[model samples]
Target: MTTPASSPSPSSSASATPPPGIPDPAAPPAVAGDRITQDRPVPLLRVCHFELVKVVSQWRTRLLLLACWIAPGLFVAAVSQQSTLPTDTLFGRWMLATGWAGPLVVLGFAGIWALPLLTSVVAGDVFAAEDRLGTWRHLLVAVRSPRRIFAAKALASLVVILLLVVGLAGSSTVGGLVAVGHRPLIGLDGHLLAPGDAAGRVLLAWLCVLAPTLALAATGLLGSVALGRSPMGLLLPALVALAMQLAQMLPLPVGVRLALPGYAFISWNGLFTGPAQVGPLLIGVVVGLVWATAATALAYALFLRRDFTNPTDGVPGRRAVTVGVLPLAALLAVMVVTVRTATGATGSGIDQEKVQRSVATAFAHLYRVQTGQLNRPDVTEAQLKATAACDKGGSTADPEGSGNDWRCVVSWHLPGVEAAGTALYQLDVTTDGRFVADGDGPKEVNGYFLVRTPTGDAPNPLWQFDGNVELLPATPKG
Candidate 1:
């Protein structure tokens, strides 16, 4: 039998014809679709848009976008009511940017249903949605390639997540500015922040705040693809986010904490402080990207390789997921160490006792007969409160390294100096081996320290009380 006429590529046109049973030489060749791109690489963005269109057109996606808008507005309003401080004040500003976007806000708003649910809803279903609806197999036939389709779907899901985050941040900021008023807020170290800095910080707080959440969404996408259940896609990511939160709170080592996305959540508190530290945040961003990418990759590999044997029950690769295990185990070890450290930290009040002894020892010299009159150490309530913060820090126990904070009330009996509430001198020594002296601090009518009554929880209007410093020691020869 004579073979069918062979077709030649356009590039091969003008070449001599082959003998019979070979492809035709003169006749225009049939179109080879694969060679269409032989001239140049197809733009990746084109593929990206193709996928984005698929995701955005879905009704659930539209509803998710709507929810992203409403969630932040309602949350900001509720916080505005409970807060006594004007949202513009130092504390209020802090609350608006970080405190609101933090885990506390997540807990209060998302409750049992975390926002990761929505992320999973989009990410998990972005691919499987097609398969679940029976459109995937048909589309695969048209695309003729599994890899390109996978990439497009993943990019589309990522774009959707980013859109959700941007929407939430924009709405929350506008809502917060309206609800709380734009005012300078305080830094984590109780320092004041300016209006410009506050605005910059609010933006950073929102942008950086959503990194881990997006990671959660990415992971949810993996679960969604594997399970093919629309609901499980949402729940799995939330559970994972919750687990990460627990890992962060377990008092793990700084290094281990650095790896956790949740640890990065509180980095926004540093915006107002003099020094900027986004170490944990950066780590979180890296780990988040890694986990998100890995999960999506593995899920795609499994889904693409497997047949439609069991739609409901996904078949995971036999290779176990040890990627998350190392960090998690390390985190758990660090947690145990941290608990031990904490328990041990409380008992060693050496620094605290040193403070008490220093005060007692220094003032004891003042009571000697040679001086004729006792010069008691003068400490204002403000000084005392500022110094004793470590002691009063939500408990009676001291923190690591004697809590790295110490203050004492230096008081002594004086013959002429009024004992009412005046301080002659003030010394402020911090536990980190530094001192804060307020020589220019307010003094009284009798040349003693003038104390200000701290307002609003003043912690007893206590300033900082430091041990006495001797200008001169009595000399026997003199």
Candidate 2:
């Protein structure tokens, strides 16, 4: 018999009509071993390494790093050749006198602009460059997660920033030491520092800038992820830095100023003084960390939600406004509230301690300079035996009140006079630390005057009337 045509084998029938969810043996495999291996998630460390390699391999990155390595040396060389000191900056007046001052000057300049620009070289381009090259898709595919890719790029940028900052600090320190001799540093407190101690303080000062620098890098990265254009990314962060610098110059409330990044940049000045005060430095650290954290988080969110497939699908306007305007508004509101609340709590009076310290320091420096002009090496600040008791508006209870009326009874011995004389000062002091005073002392010191020199090339000098003839009734010392 036809043998029932040997009904198609069950295996053949099953192959022809495979059950649901089962692979067709007759068809090519759905996934090859090579593809399975290729599709495996990349380790985070490996991704970070790849990004770092990609960044380091770029010619521009190499060039920028080279610039960072050499710029400080060139700057120091140029500054060393100058005859006039840059008295406008901290430690600038003493830069020519000691190598220790060189780092301070360089740090001041870097804080103003250089650090931001240098950091932006990598940070501003790290994320935007991928978009410019149409390589985001490839990077995402390899990393398997957008967050991982963003993190890798951001970490790479941060690494570059750290390297650049270290390079700048090292180069500047070495250049300063070489160009200017490593002599004892004269501190802001007018005390001398040993060479080793000075070097250590200078290094510490440089290290203090690390937080602000990282904040700037994070800001640049945020701009890169948000703006998506290399030039805009670079320009925005630099502009923000510049704006903050300008804001620091404004007469804003202390709380508002402390919130600014520019204030953090100069906080290292405390390290150069005797009995270093770390309050501002700590505040800077907190501000920097907050900024870096917020910017990085926002950047990661923006990058994650970005539509790489549709390049024209611009960032949503609401999202942009929320990201850009809301935070700024909140900061401003907080600042206003802080200022208002603080204003009500603060007494309308001068800080007697601050005033005393300022006056003492100012008088000492002035006396020292005046004596130097007269070639009186014997008349030292200590030998003057200057002591003062200050009173504001005839009341010690409200020393914080703002006014032009202040008085101080100062006792000091003049250069050639054996007997110590007492003087009463009719002082006009401003809240901004400016003072104009007329002093009355014993008749023996009528013509004795102190010459006040103005900074820069101005030849005009004023003779300060340090001694007056009339003595006032003694008031109770506060």
Candidate 3:
């Protein structure tokens, strides 16, 4: 140039270079993309929506929803076709009498088996799919916030679980109503439930199950992130549920059993009872929250510290081991403390006076039902004057604690019928104060195992029954 080139205009200079911290667009694509990810902050809601949409759009998810919606109808049809009722299940015998019982029967089945597995089907695959697709690095790059990603995924899983639960409940209810006629239902206490009341209670029972289902879903989500493999993630929560269920069969302390995650699934039985057992319901709510929160927190921490720099790398470093092991160890410590506390509070785990009271009450209600079936005149509980004398394992064993050797002698009288007698019942009492009482009957009073009714043959109300003893301080009968 003749002298010095004219200084570049301020506008041109500004356009040529980004600000001091910002990477220039003209830089290499990888470097520029990295800078953009670091600088950008995606809204949490937007991420959640995206994740949810992704989850729902999957073919597997759609199939699962469809199955949940249609399977119950098929079940009802199959049950209706069968001559013999599925009396072993809680509400199985009532399917023919009332359509409402179909849902309850299905509910009992799903609570034990379907809930954990169905909840896991998607939740377990959510993160593992990313690993399978080698997209963890890409996801991290796009979001740049593991915390936000975890939240979005967890929320998405829970929402999917909710949809599944609702689908099953609604489908079963509608199927039962449409296929079977809406007749009065037999309540757990052997009393008659109006059609409307039965429907309401059935729906409420399904609703009560949501808490535990969600907790199981969270466990699946954690497994997905930790295992980072689709099949393992899918199976871990289900296996855990199976283990928890098996644990329930053990002679664990009542408090410890109640505290277990699986207990929450069956705790909804409290809803069908006359007084509505609030203790189990409250315990379920607390247990579900604790498990879900703990699992999710551990998952979040692990995800945050995960090394996705080398997308295919699987060998965990010492720090990764430390990060994973420390939280699990802490969780174990807390669990140990909780178990000790619960064990200390459990005391003898059975109260004779409470057992007697519950047995007598249950017998009175059920006997009333039996009378109606026999076409006999109605009898009042006061008139029956039901009383029960209960003992734990005979004179040799601890007679005040839980055991299968418990026995109860219940005596009651029928109004206007002269011959009334006492019946002996062998009880299998659990640590939780619930029992299955097998009756040694004066056949005339307690009746046979099955009794004929207008609808069909049904289980006798008095032959064998379930009852619960309240875990309260025993007081002498007045």
Q: Please provide, for model 1 over 340-383, each residue's C-alpha lDDT reduced to its tens digit, 9 standing for 90 to 100.
A: 34333222223444444344443333223112222334443233
- Full-model lDDT, candidate 1: 0.49
Compose the digit string of candidate 3's lDDT tens values, residues 46-115: 9999999999999988898898889987887679657787866767767776789888888888988888
| TM-score rank order | 3, 2, 1
* Cα lDDT for residue 42, candidate 3: 73
lDDT of 2 by residue, 271-345 (tens): 654556455566667677767777788778777778888875433356655775477447546644543343332
> Which segments of candidate 3 are over 4 A away from where they belong?
1-39, 312-348, 392-394, 400-406, 416-419, 428-434, 452-459, 470-478
Candidates 2 and 3 compared: the better one by TM-score is 3
RMSD of 2: 9.7
- Two-way lDDT contest, 1 vs 2, winner: 2
Residue 33 shift from truth in candidate 3, angstroms: 24
Q: How many backbone overlaps does candidate 1 show?
A: 19
* Backbone clash tally (model 2): 5
Clashing pairs for predicted structure model 3, backbone only? none
How should the candidates be ordered by lDDT, best one leading? 3, 2, 1
